[model samples]
Target: MSMLIDLEHVTKLYGNVIGLNDVSLQLSSGVYGLLGPIGSGKTTLINLIMGQLRPSIGQVRIMGSNPSWSGAYLRRIGLCPATDVYLPNISGLDWVTNQICLYGIHRREAQRLAEQALALVKMETACRNPMGTYSLGMRQRCKLAQAIAHEPDLLILDEPFNGLDPVGRIEMTQFLRGWVKQGRSLIMASHILHEIEAVECSFLLLTGGRLLASGTLSEVRSLLREIPNQVRIRSPQYRLLASRLMGLDEVADLRVERELQQLLVSTDSPAQLARTVAKCVAEENIQVTEMRSEDDTLQSLFSLLMQLHRGER
Candidate 1:
């Protein structure tokens, strides 16, 4: 459980604009997701770790060494950039082989590794196609293959699912999950909450270049404990159901949306309230069609955190 990446009081500035401000965090070996909106310093943080940009203040350490350019610490790390800037004229196979060579592998070994990487990304059939001929999703897989060609201990991906369709996204998610099972570490930056939730073992949320929250999904939920949990109940007798739920001490608020034929119930304790409601249904002989929790999604969590931050400002 040693720290793979560590940042202490890390600050970055672009003249008058703040790229990152007094950010400090630690990452261990696992699939960690950096979640944030655009311009929230997600890219800046990744650049700092990659040694592409020096911090204005504080320190950045990757594998116990500073991550500045020429640090040599990057030898143990792999990077998949967010932008599509590959050599347009070169075929995917050639491009991957060239990058492996840059990592100091011999030509024959590099080619072998490149082919294996392509196969891992399911791109072996399309490996000889020129970069320009590949679709955005195909290009992303090619980039991922290149990043893993050297078999580095850690992999950093920025917007890895940026241009993928739904099926492609699912494939990418499954692939990353499998990669982490090999005991390697991965740090992925993404704006899509559902995608991050699917891939992330933990989360580091950023907003306006500042760290908002960091931890597992359950930990993040605890941070928003003040907010009531919501549930929707649908029954044949909506009015009767609403009246009974409203009488419970566990229920803090209730709203009946007549158009939807559902009753929205808010309670301070979701687990306890669910049990109470379940008992009430049995006692009342209510025919329940659907019962579900609302606003439990990661998107809702992010929205709530952003709103809280805005109110503080």
Candidate 2:
């Protein structure tokens, strides 16, 4: 299958400062989560995709065509920038409508689409309000409204839920979910791990302007199989469970936290251990309160990756 976006050994540099470093990526038509910190080249990659900045080296192809070569393909792509772009004193409706007009959409059609987009983000009632009067969350909705108004083939959003509250975030997530359910493509950049996990299991992690890893968390875990996996099992019969687990070849090390009534199990084969432990718990009817893999978290894995990248291991 052909990739919707392809980056071949791409690098972006602003003088001596590196924006991206020999990053190569291919994205098909699906939801992808871009994970990175503030200066990890997330925005630079987005800018390259949006054709706002040209790569210093290598090539970028969007929809099998060079994004910088023409504006035609941009019509099929929607982008919601992380930075603020609202024009004060203008009605939200007028702002989004004006954006649609840039695509040469007829005035009548643009207005209709704008209204529909605003409604999709649940901003129809406040569409006529001035941008200056809108809260941060409302402004975010306006940004989302502009992106989906055109119904582009691919939607790229950067830190899309920055200002949204919990309820607003849930609503926005549902909206994105429904959009992708229609077979359209989406790439979202967010610092929130759970939020990214909520929308997509696959991710591309970046750090220090370099690609750290790209795959599902489970797949990434497979890459660091040598690292001991930590599992914390809490139960009133913790000592019994620990004894059973220690007898298994799957358990490499075991520690008992008596005060916490938890047994920390270290295993080389976490996946297998998880399956075995789960089966044991169910079959034995153990009163296990919690069984979680601490080292399996994104933050922990990311930190380990960074350490490995820096030759700290």
Candidate 3:
């Protein structure tokens, strides 16, 4: 099979500021997640893949050809950028039709395809109304409609679930999942880890314009497992609980908050810790008023990964 995207020592700089720092990666066609925070070079990498910007140093190839060298290659790719296209005057149908026309399809065919795409996104009901009158979520669906109307081989989406409600988010996820089942390629950028986790794809983690890690979801998660995680439990028998937890292999450190009657544990094995806590509750009759994990969020994970990258771990 042909390579989908190949980047060799790719570095992008905007004057003195680095956009991407020596990112060398190769990806095959399927589905992928570009994960990072603000100013993490996620947009920079997407732009490079879309041929919107050429690399300042190194090489970028899409489908075995240089993207910047020819615009024709773009005909086979689709993009749904994070930014909104605020055309207050144009109706959603007209906007979508015009976007599809850019792929060289006739107006009639473009409109027909646009209608189908809109319907798929559940935007068919109010599609004839001006886009400016629609909500942010509606605009997102319209953007999605335009991107898929031409049925491009590779679809790249940035923050596709940004403005969606819970139900809308579910619909959007299902739509993308169906798109992947058709054997097409996809690259999606988002900071919400669980949403990407639900879709199940390889991940590229970026921070400060550097790619810290790239692998399948399980592989990346295993790296996270190496770091110490925190769990807080409130119990009246805090002293007894802390004493028992100190002996477990899973608990690396334990502290008791006397005033709050809470036990704070630092552990690498949260599942094992949970089991130990459950046993204590059943056999020892230790009452647990509350229990929660603190370091499970993506922000904490990213911060810890960055620290690991810098050899601070």
Candidate 4:
């Protein structure tokens, strides 16, 4: 399929500071998680895609054309920024309808679409409430309503899950999943990995003003197989298992965890270690109650990537 968005050796700088460096990526039609910590150039990349900021070097394309040419593609893209901005005097319905109307939608049609969008976000009851009186979560819903009210082909959201309670987050995640299931595209950026993980498995990893990696989580883990992983095994015969693991070159180190009942094995190849562990269990008749890895979390993966970047691993 054709690229929905593309950046080629894109570099953005603010005087002495680097916003993005040597970043090249292509996003097709699908939901994606733009994962990074704060100040990781996530906003800079989004702004570049939105044509709000011109890159210092290289190119950015959305829908096979430059996003800087706003009029040519304005109707095809929508953005929900992290910051909240609303006219305090206007009702939520009025705010969303006015936003839709700015895109040349008719007033009556805008209102109709706004109502539908609000209902989709489960904010129908508060649609008529004044913006100033709405809670933070309700205001967030209004922003989402405006973004999707026009039914843009690609929706770009910055910290979209912010201001939502746990239940609201779950509902919004499901709503986004359904939206993508219908073949529309979404790019959501968040500092919190699990929030995005709940909605999309594919990710764009960024840190220190540069693109680190971009692919499915499994693909990224595969690419970083050189990074040592710690696996916790709770076995009745912990000492015997440790001895067997120590004999293998794949196992780099070992440590006792949660007393002597559990052994944490460090290995360069987690997949290979898993296979070896299974073989050992079959041969030794070990009663292993549980097995898990500390490196499974996105944070740990990010740390490993950072370490690789720093030549520490």
Candidate 2 lDDT over residue span 110-150, tens digit each: 99999999999999999998999898999999999999999
* lDDT preference between candidates 2 and 4, better one: 2
Name the runs in model 1 displaced over 4 angstroms. 1-3, 28-31, 84-90, 104-107, 165-170, 192-200, 221-226, 229-237, 270-296, 299-313
Give the runs in model 2 whose Cα sits over 4 Å from its true position: 220-299, 309-313
Candidate 3: tens digits of C-alpha lDDT, residues 63-114: 8889888778788888999998889989999999999988889999999999
lDDT of 2 at 27: 86
Ten contiguous residues minimizing lDDT sum, candidate 2: 219-228
lDDT of each: 0.85, 0.87, 0.90, 0.86
* Clashing residue pairs, backbone N/CA/C < 3 A, model 4: none
Candidate 4 residue lDDT tens string, 177-248: 888888899999988877887876589999878888778867865765666788899998888888888879
Best prediction by TM-score: 3
Order of candidate numbers by TM-score, starting with the best: 3, 1, 4, 2
- Steric collisions counted per model: 0, 0, 0, 0
Stretches of candidate 3 exceeding 4 Å from the true structure: 234-243, 255-262, 282-290, 311-313
All models, RMSD in angstroms: 3.8, 4.0, 2.4, 4.0
List the lowest-lDDT window of 10 residues for candidate 1. 295-304
For all predicted structures, in order, the TM-scores are 0.79, 0.77, 0.90, 0.78
Error of 2 at 268 (Å): 10
lDDT of 1 by residue, 116-200 (tens): 9999988989899888888999899888998999899999999999888889889998999888888889999988767777865
